[model samples]
Target: MRAGGFLIPVLLVLAGCKPEPEAPALALHPVPVQQRLPAQVSAPALESGRVSIRGDDALADVLSWTLPEASIEQPARARAAARRALAKGDLFETAESAIPLLLALRKAQPDNAQDARLLEKARAALLAQAWIALDAGEDLASLRYAQRHGTVLRTLWPALPEAKTYLDAVDRAGQAFELCVGGERALHAGNLDTSGGALELFRRAQALWPLQTRAQRGIAAVQAALLAGAQAQAAEGDFEGAYAELSRAGRVRSDAEAIATARQRIEATRTDRIRRLGDEGLMALADPAGLQIARERLAEILRIALPGSGAGVALRQRIDLVGHYGLFRPGQVFTDEMADGGRGPALSVLPRGGFSMGAPEDEEGASPDEQPQHPVRFERGFAMTRHEITVGQFRRFVTATGATPRATQRGHSLAYDARSGNFLRGSGIDWQSGYDGRPAGEDMPVIHVTARDAEAYAAWLSEQTGVHYRLPSEAEFEYALRAGGQTLYPWGVGAPPAGAGNLAGGKDVSTRGRSWSNAFPGYGDGWWGPAPVGRFAANAYGLYDMVGNVSEWVADCWHRGYRRAPSNGQAWVNPGCRTRMYRGSSWASAPAQARSAWRASGGVDATNARVGFRLVRQL
Candidate 1:
């Protein structure tokens, strides 16, 4: 007989043979030992019938896995007979031959209960083996073994703590086995979804056994094949394919390091390929001297416009903007301002290098109108209004230049209400409402202003201060918001764990509620009125109220879509019409409406309690 005749016959029998009639199952009874030892002793009775060398060879293969360096004695003649029986597919004879040794196990135990308990454990192990085999797609063999083992476990279930575990494992294995067979049929008949579902079950089964070398390798191989297909698609210029492949890889393996590596490689490959295809190109510096001059001018503007601001906060904002938009390097700043209802002598200055820009797509109230998103790119930088033009500040300008006030109230700011002629709160006034919504106050933001009024203020300030101040282009507003990173919010995505912003008033107004309406705590959702500006944590850029206080008016006029939008960081003002852009959001809006990318618009004259403005300058 060949060296592996015993194993070869067993394997061939298992491959095609049907199960035999069930016999009374034998139990495993452990030997009683006076002292603990590293290894277990075989039962003497079974040892006598073990066919010595043939049995030893068979047991050796199984034991080697658990104890790599082991030696055993074998009787050549007895081994030869055992090997011949195995070669002839005589499993019954082989199994019967081992029973003598098994009986000795029963004798070794002191009591019938102990013998019974050990036998139950042995039965459970067989059940577990059935389960493992089923998962490996060995349906017939696993089912036969499971039926045999399960019968023994059911009889002994009351005596074993592990009986339930073995039962459950067997059930899971049965389910997986069914799926695998069904999946093979589905694949043959071209039912991709059904086939895929079964494959997924197989993958899941493999994952459950972290230490199963065969299962682990099988999973990895399947995943690698899928990724390879995706890579091919990506190579053919299918960006969607590439993304899908990477996403699949992520599902297969959630290792952070692996995911990151794949991400980097994917990006590098795509970028290189895109460049080769000439789909995009880099901008070369046009004039070094002009760029330097712009830089210096921007620095000077920042020195004046952002004086006394915390360095940490401002620097952080700048870094965020640069990273998100890839618009400018860290520390760039640019300013634009609006004034006097579009009555300008507008001053434009370069905001110094490094400013945050752009909002993410998912912010509250963000709409499709805000997409086709990219970074803000300002060729030059300058100074911007530290605060929205205040009633007092505008009043000072009026006083300095002798410009007539729209409303001639001594202390009462002239605001028009639809019902009342002059309202104190600017309740119903358009953006052009005079007196800056307060009586000569230099610190209060100029309210009730239209886009035109904002532009007028910018022009007036430029003429008086010799510094060009203008409304920040839409791009500039985003840049300022980002400040220093690619965060979802000016602060960061998700609600800050600490209560910070003034929305419906909670850690996260959008996410805090039990339901949509219940999301915010302490405050009703957009049902309550608006609050004053600077009412929440300032973003890293030193800008306050970028979200949920009041929506700030932006330089861009309304366009339903981003088609033909400018890429130079300037406001897209061509064929511009009645509607104007607003960013951030207000108390009256839902949390979704307060996202960084959120946008709103109304007629040029439209004004609301939650509408406000900030100014920027370029030098």
Candidate 2:
């Protein structure tokens, strides 16, 4: 307990609660005692002494207890009687006890070694008892017992050296206990750093008693408090306050391992939180209506993220692109609703990155036009139709706008002929016709459309959806076809994997029971003609049929090689060029034509059953 812990109510006794009406107003203590003034701060006492109500009653209590005097008695009788009392365990606090009786006998026979031995033995017993009481605990009763008896021993046995040494040891233990008590109170009140405050008191106690458990635990508690405060501040978005608390904790520990562990824990916790928020925001971009939530998540990231946080940067970019086409993540599939309740083709958001635009020169099955492999990168991401445009989707464009498709105007389009085992021009074949020039199913990919017819369809759909829609650039087409890989085929090297797409296969038996002479040895996709769009497994970017089914037209004009190709992945157009480039393998394409880098071109007005097109929306 510190000094002045309790206030002894005094002064203005007449104002006190009624005790006696006629008698003079009385004090609570019945006499004067030193008291602190109102509102005064209590000073921490190193050792708070026992308080007394300085009055006649207190004085009389102390005055009443007197020290026993050694009585004179015959030496022989005293020795016999003292021995009997010692054997009965009666040592002190009575005249009949052993110590006073020995003292009486020692005065009479100072030269007697037997009497001297008895006196010394009684003193040692008292000292040992005192040590047992003190060792029990630092509670008030134990402490008071130790201190009160120490004073008695030194006063009564003034000539004994051991008494003084034992007393000194007891005093040091008492001091250490008192210091920690004061420190604990100060810690609870948050007075940790003030002069003579908790930290100082704890250190002082440790110095006094090197192995004191109280002091050791107190220091650890202080450090824990500091670290907890730092975490709370960071949670509240107060980085300055959080760092300040961490710095304070560092001072308390200051060891390299401790500091590094503390910092790593804080950063790991924060990084995990930032990463979760970034992932949630990125997911929100997969839904166009979730753009608002994505923006909100990004705002939170900016507020709490550390400088140069990668999660924060990623979230910000995703938020920026969310408003474009209702925000889809890379490889995420989505679609837009047109004005007349018709939805555009399902599209997959393409990842923005660099890739080798054409096949490497030394690759197997490499073509002369695919030589000089060059780099191409898209600065901004774009969304590509997840599958080729289906016949049902194109029919909507034709039904809405009264436009004559090129194949319909020419009255002929090239189509597969089972008897000839080749594509041959036939009348009555148009965008509505199947590979065999029969009426195509709605789900089958639209074929036999010229490049201009495909472009016109994209333009009509753009007006319907209020967004930019066009054919993908040749570089974009190749990069997306590879889909984050550099491989000989879209699905990787060697023979095509099973069900890779509707590609030419050695096992395939056509309607005329004929298979290609040169085809993938063991691959079969279970299809003889163009299957429904997205019938096969999607590529890495969630796009389907980029290497098979039917080859598709791109925005780039025909080029001999990539020597003069655009590096930014934009369509390289030569004005008024009639020849246009188309890419990917057809269902009847040979193994060499199935290469990932394969390219071919035809007159813009040309139409064929083996060719189709898909569109991309600029983001």
Candidate 3:
């Protein structure tokens, strides 16, 4: 009993741990046996007059049972039935089976004139059917019928006038049918032009047979093709072309749903195009050149009227604002002769803004003095001369002020010697004489003038014109030189582009006696000494000779580096400041020295052939 008790406890534990047994699998029932019945054969006879044409067996039975008896005994009655069938346009029965029966009648009754007349009627009926088929554009079927009719008519009556005339008509109709077929093919091929294309061919077909269905179908196909083409053009952003195509399609099928949908799509595309143009115009407001392009784009949009169009009004307001703010207008200039009866320098209005004062650190060959690039802002706009002060302009100043320039008082000036290939102080050379010791041209930039002399000229100009004329500050000089760019040079990061400005290009080597050894490599500007003012292309601000030809005097005192430069673009002047600052490289300077950020310090009284200046009038 104790052993049994232990076994029971172990069985209980095992039962708890084990999984339950799966349910019994489904059982399949046995298939029932089918019994076969004895076969029985019974044939049903076809009706006496009815026949089945469903298969060869049925057709053969009918032909054997019915054709022979009727064809032999009642040949005349067979001919009459075939004639009646032909008259009813039942050509399949009349031509395929009845024709043979009618031939048998003619042979059996060789002297019967009715048999010949019935054969002629059959041929005439076929000719009529051929004409009908030609009108329907069934060229293959029509041609087959025409040839069969011709063969039968020729065999029976070799010179039948009616047959010949019918055949001639069939030939003419065949031509028209072929043209209609070609029109349909061209329409399927997507040639839907109104003139000299598929549509014209369709119209010609209609003109030949006014009630032809093939021509009508060809016209409908062309209309559908035009609508489809319009939809494709609209998808490709050609709204005007799409609209024109849709209008043509409307003329063809005014009630077509696709035509209406295509017109709606064209309208939507045009509206979207106008909106895009307006957005582009608004985006261009920040740049002068882009703004002009924007104006053109917006004008185009206005040319095509849109519902609720505000693009033109908005663009006009933006343009007006730009004009009111005295923004730089390309090619706009102000010119007036000075009091001394000499033509004054042309001046271009400059916009007031902030710009970086020096070159960036990564710029190639950048100097340390141009470090700490900082922003300098101008509070008001100004107008600066488009070209440097010319010799004639300085002469007028001298004639009015009765002033003696430093170079003139010195009795000699530094001049380039072409024969010796070197620069030397030449006797009897002064401001009136050029850098080559020749009489200066009236249009050439005046040279060998001290900063004080330039200041005196500005003072005389301000007094004569009753305007605030002065030398541009160092910040203003660099700002105007840069124009609107941040490159190492005014143009861009590469070596100065050809004809940008007159630097120490090799153009002077043969004419001026000497060429800069470290000049911009491989550059030749075509001028040795300073070129006539405005010879080179102007900068973005419409100022010429800002970087080369001559270093220009500014109103700043020399402070080495821009350690604490003025942020407001004012001149950094101090009391008794002996050393004044000049910006830009001279004709004798290397390419790197001609950069917009390059700075040179000279005594206020210093004069040389490489130094000159331009003036500005505050507005």
TM-score of every prediction relative to native: 0.37, 0.48, 0.46
- What is the number of backbone collisions in each predicted candidate, taken in the order shown? 84, 1, 1
Residues 296-326, model 2: lDDT tens digits = 8878777777776555675676566555643
TM-score of 1: 0.37
For model 2, where is the 10-residue window of minimal lDDT? 20-29
Clashing pairs in 3: 421-513
lDDT of 3 at 273: 65
Query: What ordering of candidates by TM-score runs from best to worst?
Result: 2, 3, 1
Model 3 lDDT tens row, 410-480: 78878888788678888888778887889999888888888888978987886576444678888889989
lDDT of each: 0.45, 0.72, 0.66
Is 1 or 3 the stronger prediction by lDDT? Answer: 3
User: What's the best-to-worst order under lDDT?
Assistant: 2, 3, 1
Superposition error at 1 for model 3 (Å): 99
Number of the top-ranking candidate, with TM-score as the measure: 2
Candidate number achieving the greatest lDDT relative to the actual structure: 2
